[model samples]
Target: MNSLKIVSLVFFVRSMEQIPCPCCGERLNVIGSRRRKYLTSQSLPQVVVIRRLRCCRCGRIHHELPDFLVPYKRYAGEAIEPVVANELPLSVAVDESTITRWRQWFAERAEHFAGCLESIRIRFGYGFVGGPSDLSLSVLQRIWHYVGDAPAWLARVVRTVANTNQWVHTRSAFCPSWQGYTIML
Candidate 1:
C-alpha cells in the first residue's frame, strides 16, 4: 500500500506539476485521487479517469493545469505553440478553437502570467523574454503593449529620429514622422 501511494505520487507530479498553484504561488501537492469522466477525443468520445491536485498551503483544489505549458487548452495545459507548430504544418496547425480557448483562459488569468513574464524579462533582459533569433510575435506584441514606459535605449532611438533635420517642409516625403516610431520608444 505504501509503495502504491508512492507510485501514484510520482505519476501525479509528472503529469500536473507543469502548473503552479494560482493562490499559493507554488507547485501543488498531488492528492493521489482519481475521478472518472467522459472526455472528447479527436475521433470519438471516451471515458477516462484523471488525477487531481490541491495546493499544500492554500488548499485550493484544481484539476486542470496552467496555460503557458499548454498550447490551445484552457484546462489541460500541454505544450507551447512552437512545439505544436513544429509537429504540424504551419498552415494546418493547431485548431483555431483551441487557440481561442487559450486566449480566453490567458485573458482571464492575465495578471499572474504577465507578472511572471515581466519578471523574467527584467531579470534576464528583453532578449530572454522569448529568445535571440526566434522571438514569438505574440509575445513581442504583448511585451511592447504592457512594458509601460520605454527604456533609455529605446528613448535614444526616438530622440535620434526626432532630431533629424529632414522635416523642413510640412508635407515633405523625407520628413520623419513621430507616429509609428514614437510608440516603439
Candidate 2:
C-alpha cells in the first residue's frame, strides 16, 4: 500500500516537470504551485494554474510556461500589490472583468500575505509613522477597493477616512444632505 502511494506521488510530481527552464533548457525544480479561480464578465468560471520553478545550476527562480502573463509571473506575496494600486492596464487585452477577477483572487489570498507581512513586522519591530491625514477621494477609493477583505477594523478605518475626505472635498459643492456619495471602493 505504501509503495503504491509513493508511486502515485512520484508520477504526479514528474508530470509537473514537463515544462523546461527557458534559460537552462533543463527540467526546472518545482518550488511551489497554486490555482486561482476567476469569474468572467459572463459569469463563466475559469481556473489559472501557476507553477514556480528554479534553475538548479544558476540558482535563479522563474516561472516555466508559454509566457502566460507577458514576461513572467513572480509568486511573491506582494506580486498583486502594484496591480491593485495601478490604474494602467498591465495587458492590452485585459478587460475590466479580468481586472475585477484578479482583485477578487488577490483578496482571497490576502490572508496568507498579511500573515507573512505580520511575521516580518514582528521580527523587525518596525513601526509606521504618521503621514498626511488628507487624501483624495480617488486615492481612498483605491485603498478601500484593494483592502476591502482585510480585518473588520481596518475596513472600518478605511471607510471612515474615505468618508471624511469626501465630505471635506464636497462640502462647498452642494448641501451636505444633497451631496451624492457612492461607495465604489
Candidate 3:
C-alpha cells in the first residue's frame, strides 16, 4: 500500500494501528524491509527502503510504498506524468521502449481508471457537477474533475482504487506470488 509522502519510516513502524490489512481487514505488523531501486523525478537512480508488513490473520505480506513510486514501475510518478500527458521530457532517462511501455500500460487502464473514479463519485455523492462528456476528456482531465489536480494525483488514484478493492492487477490471481497481499493502503 502507498502513502502520500513517507515523512519518516519510524512513523509507519510505530503507527501500524492506523493501517489495516487490505486483504483481511486485520492489523498489520512490521516484519521487515526491502530495498528497491527507483528512478527519481530527474531520472536518477535511488535506493529506497520499503518496509514489509504482515497480516497476522492471513499471513500475507505487503510492501509500504511511497507516493512517488508507482507499483511495478521503476520511475517516479513525476517522471511518468509528462510522458503520459504526451509532453516531451527535458531529458531521456530511459530507453524508447520503456516510454512506449508506460504509454501502453496507461492506455490499457485509462478507461478502467475513469470508470472507477466515476463510480466512486456516484456512490459517495461527492457533489460532482456535470462537466464535459467523457469522450471529450482526457483521462487526466476526468480524474481532475473527480479529485482535483493534486500533484500526487496518480498516487491518489492508486490509493483510491486499492482501498475500494477495485484495482486491476496485471498479474494473474492464480499465481502463487499473487496469493498473499495487495496494494498497501
Candidate 4:
C-alpha cells in the first residue's frame, strides 16, 4: 500500500514499469491487464481496465488496484459509505450479507482505526479537534471533521490510514496497550 500511486488508469497503463511490486520489493514488469466491473452510487456499473504486473525478482503477480477501488469488493468503498452511515443500500451490485460483514468488520476494528487517526493528528502537531471521539462515532464518521468536504472523501480518509501505517494491512497494532493479537482485516 505504501508504494501504491494514486494515478489514472491511463497513467498506470502507460507507466507500469516504473511501479514497484508490493510483495517482493522488486521492480514490476507489466504482464497483462484485465477489465473489472464496479458500481457507483448512481447510474449503471462502470468497467475499468487494470494492469497486472509481475515481480521481476520474486515472480509474484500483483494487480495494480486503484485507490478508489476496494480490493476484492465490487462496489467502491465510497459507494458503500451511505449504507454504512444510515439505512440499507438498495443495489443489485452488493448484498445485505456483504454489508453485514462490513458493519461487523468496522465494529471490530473501530477502536484501532480511531487510535491510529488520533496518532496521525498528534504527529502533525494537531491535537484532537473537538469532534466525535472514536468511542462516540461510527467507524465511517470517526474522521468526518478531519476529512471535511474533500471530493472522494472516502479515498482520502482511507489514504490517511493507509499512509499512517503500512503494516495495518496484515499486522495488529504493536502497542503495549493492545493485547498481542494479529489483525487481518
Candidate 5:
C-alpha cells in the first residue's frame, strides 16, 4: 500500500517535514533517509540523499524521491526531457546508451504513458490539445505540452494523475501496483 508523493525540490536539497501516505492518506512518519547516485546533465553521477517515510496506518515504506528523478531512471527528468524533445540537454552530453535506454523504456509503454497524459488533459485542460486524443504522438510530447519543461514537471503530472487514482507509486516504475495503461510513474 505504499505510494509516492511529490514534495518540493527543496526536499532533496534540505530537510523537510513529514508527508501524507499516498495509500491510506494518513500522516507519514519520518523514518530515515537513503542515498542514491543520480544522473545529472553531466556524465558524472551525483549523489542525492533522499528521505524515507513510513505510513503509520498501513506500515508501507515511502521514499521521498525528487520529482526530477524517476524511479528506476538513472537520469533525472531534466536530463531526459531534452532528449525526449529531440534536442540534447544543454548542460551535459549524455551518451547514446542512456538515450537508447530511454527510448526503449518509452517505446515499451508509449500507449500507457500517452493514455496517462490524455486522461490528465481531459481533467486539467492544460496540455496537448491537438489531432485527436488517441495518443498519436509520443507520450513525452503530450506531457511536455501540458506541464512544460519545468524542473519537477513529471512529478507534478504524476501527482495529479495519482490523485485521481489512475496511478500509484510502489517504488519501482514497473511496479505491479499500477492498475492500467493509464498509470504514470
Candidate 6:
C-alpha cells in the first residue's frame, strides 16, 4: 500500500480530529505506531516511535514523521544540509558512496523543487520575477527565505512540497525486468 508521510513533531500530541487527511481532507484516526531508526547529525544512531494515522474517508494510511526525519532518508536533516548546500569535504556517518548518492538525488530533484516553489509563489498572486540560472541555489535561497536557516530546512521543504502535492519521488520503471516484453498502453 502506498503511504503518505506527514512531517510534524507534535502529530501525536495534537488531537486526531484536528488532523485532516492530506489526500482527501478527511479527519484522521490514530491507527498504530512504528519504530524508525536514523542517524543523528553526529552520526550517532537514534530510534523514534512514529505514529501511523488512517483517513477513514479515503482509507489511506499516513506516517507521522518528526521534523528531524526525512522520508526514505536514513540520515538526519541536519546531516544532509551541508551536502545539499555544497559544503566541502563531505564528512558524515555514512560511506562516501552513500554521500555521492545523496548528492545525485538532490541534483536530480533540485530543479523540480525550484519550479514547484516558483509555481507556488505565482499561485499566491506574487509578481513574476526572474529566477537565477543556478536554480538549485535559488531554490535553497527561497526556502531559507520562507523557513529561515533552520537545521530542519530539508524536512520543511519536504513537508511543504508534499502538502502541495508537488513532491518529487523516485519510482521504479514501468517495465522493471522487461526483456523484450512489449505491451500496449
C-alpha RMSD for every candidate: 18.4, 19.1, 9.0, 10.5, 10.4, 8.1
lDDT by candidate, in order shown: 0.40, 0.42, 0.74, 0.62, 0.65, 0.72
Give the 10-residue window scoring lowest on summed lDDT in candidate 3.
8-17
> What are the per-residue Cα lDDT tens digits for candidate 6 across 1-185?
99999663422323333767878788788888888888877787777788788999988888776667777898888888788877777666777787888888887786676677667777897666645643555656766755567666777777767766675545443544467776433
Candidate 1 lDDT, 75-125, residue by residue in tens: 222222322223344332346775565455444444443445456556657
Error of 3 at 83 (Å): 0.6
For model 3, the local distance difference test gives 0.74
Q: State every prediction's TM-score relative to the real structure.
A: 0.32, 0.26, 0.72, 0.54, 0.63, 0.74
Which should have the higher lDDT, number 2 or number 6? 6
Task: For model 5, state the Cα shift of residue 177 in Å.
Answer: 21
Evaluate residue 125 in candidate 2 and report its C-alpha lDDT on the 0 to 100 scale: 73
Clashes found in each candidate (C-alpha, N, C closer than 3 A): 1, 0, 1, 0, 1, 0
Better of 2 and 5 by lDDT: 5
lDDT of 3 at 103: 88
Q: Indicate which candidate wins on lDDT.
A: 3
Name model 3 segments beyond 4 Å from true.
1-17, 89-92, 128-135, 171-185
lDDT by residue (13-116, candidate 3, tens digit) is 23333677887888888888888787866677777777898988998888777766788888988777667767653455777898899889888887787899
**Worst lDDT window (10 residues) for model 4?**
8-17
What are the runs in model 5 whose C-alpha is more than 4 Å off? 1-18, 88-91, 120-138, 149-152, 158-185
Model 4 scores a C-alpha lDDT of: 0.62
Candidate 6: give the clashing pairs. none
